[model samples]
Target: MTAQEAEDFLRTYRSMLKTWTMAVAGFSNDDSDLLYRQLEADQNVLADIAISYPEKSYSVDLLINSRSRTWAGYAEQRLPRPQNRQS
Candidate 1:
């Protein structure tokens, strides 16, 4: 995908997120499915753009990538398995 397309996709995602968030006021299966599909589609665009050097701009994809790394670290540590106790 070109840079313009990537930017447009992020804008569409933000618009969809805002509409669902404001309209529903909470999570819904429909919104979840929409978000998952959007993310999956955007992932390919992101991967394609990764090979090219960025053009000195702060994009939503870049921020989201950083945030995902941070979230992954915290999430992995948060869900530890419980140890079995001796009878």
Candidate 2:
């Protein structure tokens, strides 16, 4: 993928993550689980983007890693407590 394409994908996934997170906050248990799964899938897509674009991997890696930390923190605060969380 070109750098522009990588960036576009990153932006899309980041938006999806944020939207799903908000939806999860008000969803039923089953719905929340589904949204969480989608969020994880989006994360995988971000990883894939990094791997698929070696030419832009450095910037992509940095963007993905930074957003990951932010996502984790936001999810922790916004989502319900997990039954099987690991430290």
Candidate 3:
């Protein structure tokens, strides 16, 4: 993938993560501020990763692995395989 595409995916994924974290916090009866904070931190980390690896092409295996964790399952279900083009 191109750097721009990677950046866009990273931005979108982090946004989704934040939204999910907020939903989790809002639904919890007990203090969920810590969870929200953690999510914020995670978002920062993801942003950093995207910046650091802007030109990296993400593989399907990596996506599947990510999907195996937390809410990645939903992301996995939603994301279609990238088309492989022959030059």
Worst 10 residues of 2 by lDDT: 67-76
Task: Arrange candidates by TM-score, descending.
Answer: 2, 1, 3
Tens digit per residue, CA lDDT, model 3, 1-87: 455756676666555555554454343243334544655555544545545674443432243244235643333245554568342
Judging by TM-score, tell me the better candidate of 1 and 3. 1
TM-score of each predicted structure versus truth: 0.41, 0.45, 0.34
Global lDDT scores for all candidate models: 0.50, 0.60, 0.48
Candidate 2: tens digits of C-alpha lDDT, residues 3-73? 67778887776665555556544333335456556666666666677678766567556655644464344
Candidate No. with top TM-score: 2
**Candidate number achieving the greatest lDDT relative to the actual structure:** 2
**What lDDT is reached at residue 70 by model 1?**
27
Residue pairs whose backbone atoms clash in candidate 2: none
Candidate 3 residue runs with Cα over 4 Å from true position? 27-87
Question: Root-mean-square deviation of each candidate, in angstroms?
Answer: 10.6, 8.6, 15.1
At residue 9, what lDDT does model 3 achieve? Answer: 62
